[model samples]
Target: MARSARLAAQGLAIGLVVGLLTLLVWRVANGNGKGVAQALADGEHPTAPAFDLSRLDGRGRFDLASLRGKKPIVLDFWASWCVPCIHESRRLEAARKEYGNRVAFIGVDTKDFSGDAREWQKKHGITYPSVHDGSGSVLTKWGGLPIPRIFFVARSGKVVGELIVEEDLPRYLREIAAS
Candidate 1:
């Protein structure tokens, strides 16, 4: 009888562990783990932090405040060495082309060498302007590390959504466009 009781207890513990793991996986897959979706759902639209950074290709600077009221802005934080950034860069370029003048796309190259960032952009044939955040101060101001983080700011200068995964980016962009 004691042996049967012990086996039942072990099975219950295993079931609880499995349930917790499943919940975590579901939360991550549905974008709840990052709290981004929850924040948006709670009507917590915050103004995107302002920053002025030089362009990667020796071009002029990009001022966040300058983009306000002009068009919807898409800010993508990336690094040249991050593999996922490469894939997301292509998707962003395609989205930029599709959206045309309706939206403004800006890439923030954080924690990467200027030469490497410029080379990556050139190799990828990226035409959008990219800001250099070598010191990562801008990244810190916006949020912490995580290469390939994206923020969608509406025309009014309010950040509507944030995304970490590249796969969910297009859907988020579409939702922004629709808004």
Candidate 2:
């Protein structure tokens, strides 16, 4: 009985390992492989992954590809529940006032409800446009999780950099604006 139980346990462990491996392979096959953050860390400036999602406002959908070559973009990923996102987004709003004409400030409301995101935007006084990323699939491409991941894409559509520090915000904004 003891020997049989040990064999069963081993089989279950092997099954779990195989399951995890299959999931990893599936994600890689579906374009959910290495993220933009990893590519940046490896000294690569990849093209910003495109997404078309519904606007938090009642307006029509927003397509990232639409502005790809035409304008430099500041992509801000945030959720209503994230406290830190409030501050970061507010700062972006202030920056937008100065750079709005030259640069596009787009927000991706990741893994959050549309109504709440809209409310949050209003409450925080964030005037720039935002699209809902309820499933977080778009967020996965730009580097998933930890909320408030802001990236700058040049006019050429190449992702320039992500905001790593408070100082990075203005620096990236300037770089992308000039691109």
Please give the clash total of every predicted structure, in order: 0, 0
Clash pairs detected, candidate 2? none
Q: What TM-score do all the candidates reach, one by one?
A: 0.72, 0.84
lDDT of 2 by residue, 46-69 (tens): 999989999888699999999978
What does the lDDT come to for candidate 2?
Answer: 0.93
Can you list the residue pairs that collide in candidate 1?
A: none
- What's the true lDDT of residue 87 in model 2? 95
| Whole-model lDDT per candidate | 0.81, 0.93
Candidate 1: tens digits of C-alpha lDDT, residues 34-141: 343345657788777789999897879989999888778888889889998887778889889888578889999999999999999999878888999999887776
Model 2: worst 10 consecutive residues (lDDT sum): 25-34
C-alpha root-mean-square deviation, candidate 2: 5.5
lDDT of 1: 0.81
